[model samples]
Target: MSLNDASCTFESMTSPTTLKTSTEPPLVSAVHWTRAQWLLLMVVCTVLALDGLDVSMVGVALPSIGQELNLGTDSLQWIVSAYVLGYGSLLLLGGRLADLLGRRRIFLIALSVFAAASLLGGLVDDPAILIATRFIKGLAAAFTAPTGFSIITTNFAEGRERNKALSIFTTFGASGFSLGLVVGGLMTSLSWRWTFLVSVPIAVVVVFLGMKFIPKDKPSAENSGHDIWGAVTLALGMLGLVYTLVSAPEQGWGSVATIAGFAVSIAVLAAFAVIENKVKHPLIRFSILKEGWVARANLSAVGLFGSYLSFQFIVTMYLQSVLGWTPLGMALALLPAGLLVATSAPFADRLIEKFGATQLILTGLTALGLGYVLFLRVGTTPNYVLDILPSVVLLGIGFALAFPSINVQATAGIKDSEQGLAAGLIQTSTQVGAALVLAVTTALVSGHGQAAGTVSAQAMLEQYRPGLILSAAVAIAALLVAAAPSRRRVRT
Candidate 1:
């Protein structure tokens, strides 16, 4: 039956048999998977894949990018930090705009912009332009990521069908991230620019499919009203805070710029909170904060993702610099971790349903902590089979288990209207955590490098050992938080 007919039928059914009647229709009948929907989802996943590739690929290409551009250790960070800042800061606003405008429209626009930005990044000769392009690329990602979720959630009916679709969507996201590492390695072997240019064709195809398949849905009344002041304040606040975090490792904590950034961040975020409370249409609904599960889930994501990103960065440096491995070799060594992350996710989903989100998250955190502790053994003596492989496998399993569980819990008790906002918030916490931890770890490594003359690869590896241990400690803390009475008491 057509979607219009299905809607009419749904409206007409008011009796106890409504549930029965609803089931009588084909599962796909509820919402037609038009060419538009298929194209949109494909492109969304593809764009996300590109985002993942850019992130992982840059790290693989960093040495080359740095060598060519003559970047110092501290300035090199801008390539990563700039993209994250733009992506994280604009996510919430992007979601709101998708809800207010249209998901299909936004998805297309985002793809086009992302493609252009990728082109710019690839072609740029100057380091400043490269950083600027990365920032712009991130802006495009912010728009696309949240809209992808919103579209799937809105288009698919809830329960098993929605669950399956979301799982598939998330799988693509995870796989894309992992696959990017492999692709980045291969591309960087040819040239660092290929890493960025690779996305152009994918983006172009995604845009074409998005235009064809995704349906055009009118904006809901709640989403139509945009809070300009609230958005501005929130963006400014997040930018200030993230900038402070990214810069702190390079500039001392006592530096004037660092101090001012943090101070302004606190003030602006405080102002944002006040504005949110008073605004007629707030960017984030204050009422959602009262939900215990939502709060815990977001906090858990921050801690969990912080550890994950730091480990990825540290390991990359260790493999290439310390072990005397090429980018391709490092990428190949890390392939098992990515595969494990992908392989474990489906099992993690089933575990979530059976044991609930809290249990799964706690288990995942425990695994992640143990993985880090195991990684402390990684030294100048390269033993992939005995030491590093086991750690990578455990790390992969931990992340695969934790991410989906937290995502489920965060979105679980929210109304449809609030889903986009909640998803945006979760993603924001993830990027912010990554940025913060990376900065902290980089600072520690840099300080150690300076103290030791002619910083050897082994010395750099030793420097990060302390940081990794600390990250493991943080994971243990997260496990405790997840297992706490308050978290356990809250029901989905």
Candidate 2:
């Protein structure tokens, strides 16, 4: 069959069996889907879901993890920061490898590694080992997450079909992250280790299904010419920058270690830019960076994600520490945000198609900024209905609108071969932004703490307000950036 005919047949075959028309020929009749496709999709969804859960779940279990591990406030930050460091640093490399190698192979291998790391983390008794395992898991996640997108990109032809599939994938990812809080809360009530252990079964199922159904792509001949030096420089530079941010709270900004780290990051990143400009096959092409929409979308992501991460971290702490809510209660309280994120995202695609990404992104930022302002007005008195819920709903709506629009805009007009690279850049910016904001906000709040007896609940709340307010201002800045004429349209 011709390519178009083959695709048409495949589309009709993949459609719901119940919808088959009576006039359709017997051979063209929709065959019952084998166990493979269902299992494979489930497995991939599980992997994405676990990623979502792990990111949010830790917040719920942080208090317990700290108590059991005998960790201080700074160490608590390290636990999360270490993971982001590993994940963010390797994201681009992961995407590159998926394109260079094969998405199926990389995904399965990464999933296996992630599973093993999760197991080690769950079983480890020592705090140091736990942190190390978390880092390993993050590294594995860096490999797996982008590959999920790559798989969809390769398997589904672009247009309405690809858009719908991607939408479902993105929605599941969002849901996974939000639901993870609920799962983590429940699991932590039993034992903090359960949070890590939960991944074991899901990973097994995903790996098994993935092997059965995920299509294998032949290695690209062009991939052999990858710029290894560019990859190394980029990773190291990001690592240095993230380390400096995460460590600055404890080491002090002026300390030699922090200063050295920042200096090295700047120098290394500059070197990376220079190398990319000269190299024939750079890890990230300089040409792509010159694209206005791609650059602005990524820059906006840095600010948008940074604010969101910082807000969530602070709110989780406030609910548990100040309000004295259990993990379960806190999870329940945050459910609206999670549901909103999942429900609103599909509609965002339609909005983008009608009004374009620029307007949707701007509106999202406005909603997010307003949400933060509303959250800042929240007092020590626990009034969840009036103070917290409104902000949660608004923030949910904002992120739901923002995330997919940014993804679509960033990838629009890019060549098929470059899609993986663009996807990696987007994911890396998000995690790095989270790490940056968390570090800065933590340092600011920790530094503002009152004398031991004077540290009332309200005083603690007041200290956190500055971080939230700063986050709001950052969102406003993102709105401004999104509104700029340079980013007003995706260049074809």
Candidate 3:
């Protein structure tokens, strides 16, 4: 059934007695939202989907771009890493800007930048210029993503309505990535540039619709002072940290460069913390992390995205390098996880409501860990149905359940004024945490390959297994974190 149909069914099933009886207008589930409300949600979701779409599509086209540009592996790697570095660094600032400025204003401006960057990225010939454009796009996305998230949280009421809205929003984001793989494969066959160009028009339409439908509000007068020092330190600190993590594998984890990078990053961040404490108006209120659920939810997001990225890296390597599968075939093989996440939009919020976000998270992590464990049994020639499909299905189910719920819990009790701050924190955790895990996983795979030089296909398969094991271990650790008792903490 269509989304509207499912929503209609849900609306019909609700009892009138259960509805709010006060004079304040009744809170409506997303299924019963008016056209304008739905349109507003779509506008924000489209921006997020564009972010996901751009990332995945560019990933698929990397080989073609390398071939055409005559770039080495190191140079080509920067094409992706530049984007991540920009994105992971400024997410905190982006979210705070949304709250300080109007969400509508910040969102529209950033999206415009994103569109402009996409256009430049597609047209550019110089590899350095192309990488710069990717970084610009990532910087734009860092703003749009959290602002879009806060837009929903502020516009929708806090219970079922917001839950459903977030589920649908995240589904669109996940689906965009899933579908982009297929789209990228097709576009790359014609030209690698198409992947970059494709997002431009969609982003333009979104910007236009946002202007018309998204309501505007003025910034707070009570908090007019700018925290220039805080912003600088935080941004610099995050940039240094993410850059260090992204480069550590290639630089050697114990190298002087990596050590100095970490030291500088940590010291800068410590300065940021002191500034936040002393400033009349801080960039981020450090107290938000004191809320145990909020902290746990952020950690969960880190684990969720971290493991998934690492797993995807390993799977992509295995499918293409070992099995000699086409890009399109690999895309199809992984399509089920994306499909499951997309289809779960209808019931994900309902599941959150019934089981509670905490329960669903624990269960989802269990499934995710098991999926990684199952993949450990992979051989040189394995049955897709027996060895892969089951793990794929479990991973799909795990993500479909956990991702939305983690989002819900993160922002649940947060006041609307700081909603953008809360949103940025969780998203920042996801990106930065994923970078760290993927770097370590890459190091493991690379180290193993060097140890067993000129290995057979079977031995090559063995090289990637350690990364797979790391992914599973991360999931299990996260599961333990979620399952821990938090009665006092939740109350606090």
lDDT of 2: 0.76
Q: lDDT per model, in order?
A: 0.74, 0.76, 0.85
Please count the clashing residue pairs in each candidate, in the order shown: 5, 1, 0
In model 3, the runs with Cα more than 4 Å from the true position are 1-31, 451-455, 487-492
**2 or 3, greater by lDDT:** 3
Which residue pairs in candidate 2 have backbone atoms (N, alpha carbon, C) closer than 3 angstroms, thus clashing? Answer: 52-177
Candidate order (lDDT) = 3, 2, 1
Question: Which digits, one per residue and each the tens of the lDDT, describe model 2 over residues 1-492?
Answer: 112111222222223132234365533222233465445556666787788888888777878999988888767766777788788888888887888777889999999998898898888878888888878888888988888877766665554445445556666777888778888989998999998998888898779878878987876556757787888898898878877887888898788999989999999999999988888777777567655367777878887889988888788878877777778998899899889887864565455544455666777888999999999878778688899999999888888777766766566555666767777887888888877877788788878776778767798787787788778988988887777654222235
Which regions of candidate 1 deviate over 4 angstroms?
1-40, 344-348, 450-458, 487-492
Scored by lDDT, model 3 comes in at 0.85
Best model per TM-score: 3
What is the lDDT for 345 in model 3? 89
Query: Lowest summed lDDT over 10 consecutive residues: which window, candidate 3?
Result: 1-10
lDDT score for residue 124 of model 2:
83
| Per-residue error (Å), model 3, residue 134 | 1.1
What lDDT score goes with residue 109 in model 2? Answer: 95
